[model samples]
Target: MPKARRKPEALDGQHFEVVVVGAGMAGLASALRLAMFGKSVLLLEKHYVVGGLNSFFARGGRKFDVGLHAVTNFPPKGSGKASPLIRLCRQLRIPFEELALSPQSFSRIAFPDVDLKFDNEFGFFISEVERLFPREQDRFQKLLRTMEAFDAYSPEVAGDVSARSILGEHLQEPLLIEILLCPTCYYGSAVENDIDFASFVMLFDAIFRQGLARPLDGIRRFLNPILKRYEELGGKRRMNLGVKHFVTKNDIVERIELDNGEIIFADHVISTCGVVETERMLSSASQDENADDVSRISILESIAVFKKQPADFGWEETIVFYNDADVFRYERPDELTDPRSGVICIPNNYRYPNGEQMAEGQLRVTCLANYEKWVALDENSYRSQKEICRKAMLEVALGYLPNGNSMAKELEERTELLDIFSPRTIKKFTGHLDGALYGSPRKSRNGSTRFGNLYLAGADQGYVGIVGAMLGGVAVANNRILRGD
Candidate 1:
């Protein structure tokens, strides 16, 4: 399909200065920022809700975050000087209560015998790390400092330093390496080759500062406000709306064609979809070479928002499990059983006594899954895919519970498939390049994407994380708006 060229002509329709596609956090953040700056922005989300990954679903009166479980970003100095997320929260006047994670530890790393607890304060966190890896204490501290430096490293301070450069090679603790890389690997990157040090730092910051806290109602509270805020600012959203492809002329994108055969024009199209899909949608020429090559990147899945009753309601806050560095994600799978280990993230157990909301109890389990297989099936086969996923989750849940099977059977009968979050899902729903949850790996030290006006953001450009994604939005928008693209 040929792209319709911008005529340098009169305004059509409402004349939006920017058209944001995909209502995920990145897109929502970008659009909100632009709107606050007084730009006439029109935001489009395929889903009914405004927040993409941040949205929630309700079943059995319990609402769980479909994508976002927790949040990071410290509250900042004072009222009006909070961090970006805080700023958005305040600007929207969304009243939120801050709750610290249970056990006063952010994450408990349990290896075969070593039980290391991580905290919100960086200094405390490092001290704990140093205690666990005493032999390499000096090197471990240096690694922590280096990662923190990467978090605060301004583009101006970068001063030609290569992004691919390692922080330091002196720390050789195999267990430390596993701990450091396991979280990064969840971003779908190769432990050795996929990420830059900046990404690692950003992720660490997120966990440390934003000790996992769910909203009062659940994950929906966070997103519902953001969606309301987006709409309040006059953002446009269409549920069940799907974009088939985009049209570009020369170096500029002119219009996006929806699956319903309608064309929506934009001065600029900021898609949350990834690079591979962007190339396919915006490529003016007619060749379809290497399309599926981009299609086949592996996906991470879990029984996201797995609902169940815990043995003890207080166990909700304390993640009572035996997950070392290798317990969760350790394999390439076409289903959940591939890795053989699964993670149970019990949010309600951390804090709070059971009141009226406590029906039986709230136990949330997420297993690393192979989401690609779900994409291969037709609608009829989806029911069977759900069964495979349910069984896989049950096997992993049985690791801790003596009565896990009966509980698992109860869940299998009631749980919903929710959504299939694959590369293609990210492509269609979020519009990220390569179905990248985070953006592509830096790939080179020079930091070039080999194209003009085409840039990366969210988890693509630098790192992949809550903070990384936010900073990615800032970086790409800087190139386009701040730098006069």
Candidate 2:
């Protein structure tokens, strides 16, 4: 059983072996892994709930996932033991079956002139690419061979190398390049309009090679078991509490100041906060040195719940990455949102076991948005603009669907609830500057900082998705804290 929640006063003078900031996937995994080895760990989260970017909320008696479209890096059962998902489960000592993962039925990359569909099978995706861009078949295969040989996890290798430049070297078709980049950038890129080659390789393997899946009961179902296992193993976590600052001495984080002004100490500290966010938390005078590295990328997401399944309206795919123009633009929009290119996800499209399905249809659309524009709005205007953008995004997204024009009316009429979140909402909840979804453009591949005992994890640690984040956390704990590398 877990210990009772410790109040701020009770933990004021407490000392721990390791202090993990942010109870997201990385923090939870790190704390749990350390505790399993009989190390004292303290996990802190500012929000009332866990899961960080992949968290959920209850609205109108219905649960809504915030950042998760689908859990990437999903390999089949008894296969991919060396895969990130399997490795994460193995490291955390969590049974793979406990995840209750359901593979996506299919997902597509839809452009103005072409559509390419793929599922769990890598061969199917390969065939789709060949059929859509037949001339580039050999080039695509050669590119894959190159990616397969690249060591993406090497800490010594520079991660900021341009993936576009590399893609151009392998493939001649601009459309094929754009189509491939569409899903990869939307899924994990922090760099505007392009992704680092290392990240590109990682995401390509995770999304296209390994594929996407989701827990049938939402993120909570996957997180609850991890939290339980951590608690059962004598790990401690405090929710609705956060670290205000890290007091450093001689290149070491010696003390931690809680949000309530309580002071604590830890032999080692692992921060899952984004690079810029974590840098800002340092009490030292040079805290803002890396402020310029803050990411400009943010997103506008809207969710609509309706009475009928999306398949009823001929929308059978689990997710659709769409672009209206030939050249897919992924940069931060000057306006509140750029709905021309976005992602549309139907959660009900997943193939659940025993023919199970969601009680209602849920459609989520995500678009690139300007954080500054959204944050500058007044309260009333913010609310009003959300509604405005919600309608606009849905209108643009509908065009990509089959029989889109006819289904729009029925969708609006059947929609029982509608909610939209802007970059402002993201900052308020996740504390990420400018609501950057994937964190800083510069990644810390080794999870190191200037301080000897301090380290970084999660997004800024050069990992993406839930499983990747957990694996990153485990790596930090095993390599830095426990192994003392």
**Clash number for every model?**
20, 0
Each candidate structure's TM-score, on Cα atoms with residue i matched to residue i, is: 0.76, 0.96
Candidate 1 wrongly placed segments (more than 4 Å):
1-9, 12-14, 60-62, 74-106, 151-168, 187-194, 283-331, 334-336, 350-360, 377-382, 398-436, 442-456, 482-485
Candidate 2 per-residue C-alpha lDDT over 1-485 given as tens digits, one digit per residue, 9 for 90 to 100: 11122443455448787889998888888999899998878999999999888888888899988898998988855575768888888898888889999999999999987999999999999999999999999999999999999988666668789999999999999999999899999998888999998888989988889988888889998789889988988788888999899998778887899999888888788998888888888996565677778888899999999999899999999999999989989899989999899999988988999999999999999999999999899999999999999889999999988887789999999999988888987876677888988889989988998888889998887777788788889989999877842
Model 2 lDDT vs. the true structure? 0.88
Cα-based lDDT at residue 318, candidate 2:
91
lDDT tens per residue, model 1, 51-93: 5545665554555455554555544235343354554444434
